[model samples]
Target: MMKQLKTLLIAATLLFSTSQVIAQAKIAHVDTNEIMSKMPAMMEAQKQLDNLQKTYDKEFKTMVDEYQSKLEKYNREAETVTEQLNTERAKEVQDMEKRIQDYRQTAQKELNQKEEDLMKPLMDRAKAAIEKVGKAKGYQYVINSTGLLLADGPDLTTDVKKELGF
Candidate 1:
């Protein structure tokens, strides 16, 4: 009876540990955007994009304000004014408004493109770092946390974050 009991206990322990090992997963997650934000090159690019956006916004505002002032003046005096001035002033305001709209769209698109361009190297670095860390740490799989929405790989994130110094 004792021998049978010992054998059963040993078999149970071995079976539990084997199953635990089999159930273990080597999955990891990394936030590419988070990594990109910490890159010095990306920071400088973001600064440049911000400055450009501010400058363009100011310019667009000035153009719109100028047009609005002219339009308001025209409306105030339009009833008493000759048809010639009315037509010319209306045309000017329309042209100015169109220009402002175009400039705003262009400036926004340009800034977005610049931001994308600036992010490339940072993204590359992050990916490279992830690859390196994963290999060194025996990570069998690495996934971008961006797509996960939520994940239990917080340990992987913390480790990667520390390793990247981000």
Candidate 2:
């Protein structure tokens, strides 16, 4: 009698689970990368960043070139002078090299900060858009590419993109 009761309980649980699975829950996926690509503001920001990066590159190259020229000229002069001059000049060159390295590192950090500063507003806009889109469309849950990979589960990304154009 106990075995029969347990079997009935298990059967009822399975039926309830199946019903829940078949419930009317709207689910969709949104590809964030697609939205970012389509956003004109984001594109413009990227172009600005590209130009800034090029300028930074040129500045760094000019600095290195100037240093190299000075080092070359010093070597030539040292070849014609005493060992004492060579030692002093070598120390000077090493100090200059260290300063250049520090400058390069600082410049890179500033560039990264600049990118974040430029992009923060755009990112916030995209996030707000996601919530706005989700609420308006009656989606119980909107999933992203990141979600699918993180869960290692089925993807509804295409359906969401088709429905939302995002």
User: lDDT: which candidate is best?
Assistant: 1
lDDT of 2 by residue, 33-75 (tens): 7766667778898998889889888988888898899899997
List the candidate 2 regions with Cα displacement exceeding 4 Å: 1-25, 146-166
Q: Write the per-residue lDDT of candidate 1 for residues 1-166, one digit (tens) a residue.
A: 9999999999999999988875685877777767766666777887888898889888888887888888889999999989998999889888887888888889889888887887777777677778888878887788888888677864355566666676
Clashing pairs in 2: none
User: Worst ten-residue run, lDDT, model 1?
Assistant: 153-162
Error of 2 at 65 (Å): 0.6
| TM-score (all chains, Cα) for each model | 0.73, 0.72
- lDDT for every model? 0.80, 0.76
Cα deviation of 115 in candidate 1 (Å)? Answer: 0.8
